[model samples]
Target: MMQAVIDRIVEGKHAVVLIGEDEVEKIVPIELISDNVNEGDWIEIKIDNDGNIISIEQDTQSTKGTKQRVKNKMELLRKRSKRNK
Candidate 1:
């Protein structure tokens, strides 16, 4: 299993995820996911030998931490944007 963060969801198509410390991005089909996931949610993904997603599950601790980090960055960006206005 590998840990990844959901970067975005493409509605009925797929989800883009960021993996590893280098933040390598991968696309996963929406149907492979077991539950609804939002951006910044951390997940554990299992892939088959052919590089197909077999399972995906949310990792609560990682998700919370990632969400907090994203929220903080967004807040900082918002403050910066307001100041530039």
Candidate 2:
């Protein structure tokens, strides 16, 4: 199959999507898909006979977020950890 950029990946909450060309769409409960594959990366996906993502391959260049965003999330995680302690 021609490799398609993950136009979007919506997990949990019914878990279906209508993909558009050359645009952005929000994939919900992104964690589920992320857990199965890697979050924020283009994956080699295979649609099964049932039309589900039955397979995936990692594309390292597809990492999500600007450096600032990653830093902010790490900061938030650190703050939360400190609070838990």
Candidate 3:
């Protein structure tokens, strides 16, 4: 297991991850993992006995009120759309 930075998402199944000073392009089932991961984010990846990256855990900041943020974004979008009409 090592720390890596997500670079470019080539497709739904593959992405280029930068580990240390080397970038390894791996075909992983990232779709099986959580969508919380994004480009430029740091994650801990583990390769199983099959030599496949089986699990990925992102290093994220803990925050409260996620529901409030979504509501606010929706409200802002609604207001913008109304003004455009």
| Cα lDDT, all candidates | 0.83, 0.46, 0.66
Give the per-residue lDDT of model 3 (tens digit) for 17-50: 7764466655555674468776666667777777
Which candidate number has the best lDDT?
Answer: 1
Off by over 4 Å in 1: 69-85
- How large an RMSD does model 1 have? 3.1
Clashes of 2: 0
Tell me the alpha-carbon RMSD of every candidate: 3.1, 8.8, 7.4
- TM values, all candidates: 0.69, 0.32, 0.53
When 1 and 3 are scored with TM-score, the better candidate is: 1
lDDT of 1 by residue, 1-85 (tens): 8898888988767999887778778898887765667877889987788877778898889878867988999999999999999
List residue ranges in candidate 3 displaced over 4 A. Answer: 61-85
